[model samples]
Structures are given as structure tokens and as C-alpha cells.
Target: MRAQIGDRLVLEGTHLGDARRVGIVIAVAHDDGSPPYEVRWLDTGRATLIFPGPEARIESQPPVADVSGPA
Candidate 1:
């Protein structure tokens, strides 16, 4: 899957009773928006680079203050 910076990543738990992890994509390593994203987790407020697994889902949002658009 492809994602941009500011996108939310939700990683599903592998087994029952496991809690899902949620993080926001802070940096996109590739220009094509591939894996190996830098994410700041919601729980710990720490950042890490991650290659998403099969259970990962991307939640995209609009860019804050589109600079080129009319005010």
C-alpha cells in the first residue's frame, strides 16, 4: 500500500486479546510512498521506522493548509 506523511497507520493484532497499534506516518522514505515509514506512535509518542505487515491499514488525511490554494 501507498501512504504519505501525516497518514495514520493501524496495525492489527495477530491473535485474539491483542491490542492493535496505531501510529502516524511522520516521514515517507520513498518518493513513491512505499514501506519503511517513520511513525510516531500514539501510545508512547515515540518515532520508529517500520515496514508494514499484512495487517497494516492506512488512513489518509488532507494536507494542512494547502499552500498553493486560495486563502
Candidate 2:
């Protein structure tokens, strides 16, 4: 999955259930955009940072400063 910055990532609720979290992609690393992402997410308030896999489904827009581009 070619997840670009500014995209959103929903912590697969179908799998994680209540524990599921969701947030938007803030920053990318390696300048190559590889697995083990370094995302700045907002789990419904509390700002959280994680390094999920590339296969992690992206939302492209959740709730945060869109890192995609443009205003």
C-alpha cells in the first residue's frame, strides 16, 4: 500500500475492535516511504505516535494537519 503523508490510518476496528484507533499521517521517513511508518496520529484526542506497517489501511483524511500538500 503506497500510503502517502496527509493520509489517515484507521486502526482496523474490525480486527482491533474497541481498542481500535484512528489518525492521520503526519510525517514520513527514510525519504523513501518504506514499511514501519512513523505516523503522528490522534486516537480521538490524545496525540499518539506509532510505527505501523505499510499494509496498514490508510484513511487519506482523519483529523489533523493534512500532510498531503497545498493549503
Candidate 3:
């Protein structure tokens, strides 16, 4: 899957009772946004380079809403 920096990498648990893992894409290895991303895991607060498997999916950053009043 493709991802950009700041996107979240969610690795779904393969077995029952296993917790899913989530991480942020701190770096992208390819210009086209392909995998082999450097992720900073939320739970462990550690970074690692990963060639994500089938269980992995990318969660893009949500759009930022304008907080300021309309001008």
C-alpha cells in the first residue's frame, strides 16, 4: 500500500485476542508513496523500517478544519 508521512500504519491482528498495532509514517522510502516506510509506533514509541504485509493498511491524516471565524 501507499502512504505519506504523518499517515498512520495500522496492522490488524492476525489472531483472536491479539491487539492491533498502530504507527505513524515518519518517513517514506519511495517518492511514489510505496511501502518500506519508517514508522514510529504509538504504543512503544519506537521507530522501525517496515515492508508492511497484507494485514497492514494506511490511514491518511484527516483534513484540518478552519478554526478561525469566516472573514
Give the Cα lDDT of each candidate.
Answer: 0.95, 0.61, 0.96
Error of 3 at 36 (Å): 0.2
lDDT score for residue 23 of model 3: 99
Q: Candidate 3, 58: how far from true, in Å?
A: 0.4
Better of 2 and 3 by lDDT: 3
- For 10-61, candidate 3 gives per-residue lDDT tens digits of 9999999999999999999999999799999999999999999999999999
Candidate 2 clashes: the total is 2
Name the lDDT value of residue 15 in candidate 2: 55
CA error at residue 32 for candidate 3, angstroms: 0.2
RMSD in angstroms, candidate 3?
A: 2.3
Off by more than 4 A, model 2 = 14-17, 53-55, 61-71
Error of 1 at 26 (Å): 0.4
Q: Write the per-residue lDDT of candidate 2 for residues 2-26, one digit (tens) a residue.
A: 4567776766544534566667666
lDDT of 2: 0.61
Off by over 4 Å in 3: 63-71
* Candidate 3, residue 34: lDDT: 99
Q: In candidate 3, residue 68 scores what lDDT?
A: 100
